[model samples]
Target: MTELRIILFLIGVAVLGAIYYFGTRKKVDIEDELDFSEGEEDIVSVRPNDLPRKKSGLTVDEAHQAHEAENVQTQKDKIVTLFLHARDGQQFDWHLIQSAAEQVGLEFGQDNLYYRFKGFGNNKELIFMVANMLKPGIFQPDMRTTGLVLIMTLPGIMPALDMWDTMFPVGERIAEILGGKLTDENHHIFSRQRIASMREEMREFDHKHSIQ
Candidate 1:
């Protein structure tokens, strides 16, 4: 019985040793296989041109301008169509539009302004009156009414302005016929700072128009 017990103990020890050796060797073999599959010689070759580098001196403004200008142009293309017509059959004035355009610079009409005139209090019919005269079919801002309309649509485009604050700039529209007084009640969405900045911009805009 003692001899049998010794033989059984020896057999148990040999089995545990075999299990430990095989377990360690199996782990090593798995690691080797992974390394071999991912060998340096098998790595993909990337040319210097294929490696993308961060472009230097790229501004957010430039990127945005590029992205927006990727397709059609003109402010009319950017948003829902709104036509500008002079009341009483007076011709829409080009000088006025040019002056307003000058305020915002050469890029003014490039998909930034989109005007929908609901009119101030007591004047809900204004939009219908203007629309009735619109020539059917889509058109970019006409030579006549471009500048005056640009001013109203220019102020609310900063990235900081929340979508709700994107109301039209009712003040400083710079047209003798219109823009004298719109009630400020509905326009309170703008910060005082924004209004002040817009006014200053219009002043500069007017100055540019005078020179031309």
Candidate 2:
């Protein structure tokens, strides 16, 4: 009877060990599966960059090139400038020119009923200005020893073609008032034919860029 009781106790011990081992293993397997599932979820969220490139319409390199091209074109467009020269290699009289410019600004402002013209920069040596009637910063005035060069530009975009009507006329008027000469970038005398050609070129640009 004693031998039989010892055998029963040994059997119970072996049964409990087997149960503990299997339960622990099952728990470990469940925890591992949960971790794997969470890892897959994380991968899905973070792999958006790996999505089909065609679905985004352009690859990263192509997008970057397009942006660069746009910048180049804007620079080119801004370079289409108009100029006015003071007579006989002289610099403009600041007070007289400023008064004439202000008058022109006021007249244009009244006609537009919305846009104003204001000078830019704090340099007492120069009279830099912009079309307040249109968008701010669309025009910039460069005062050199020879004359003032007006570049049609904004911070990052091209100047509007419609602004040419106002800009060129205002420039011519100011030059006339100041006894200055209206000249091209090369200091060539401005003539009817030259202005007509400029207008045609601007129209072409406006058409191409769908500006008007």
Candidate with best TM-score: 2
Cα displacement (Å) at residue 127, model 2: 16
Q: What Cα-based lDDT does every candidate model obtain? A: 0.28, 0.41
For model 1 the TM-score comes to: 0.23
Clashing pairs in 1: 97-147
lDDT of 2 by residue, 1-212 (tens): 32222222222222222222222323233322211111112211112222122212454565555445545644343333455666664666545645675778632222111122333332111111222111111122432233444444322123344556656777788778878777665557888999898878767766766742
Give the top-scoring candidate (lDDT).
2
Go through the candidates in order and give the clash count of each. 1, 3
Estimate the overall C-alpha local distance difference test score of candidate 1: 0.28
lDDT by residue for model 1 (117-162), tens: 3444334211110111111111244433211111122112222122
**Residue-level lDDT for 81 in candidate 2:** 47
Weakest lDDT window of 10 consecutive positions for candidate 2: 35-44
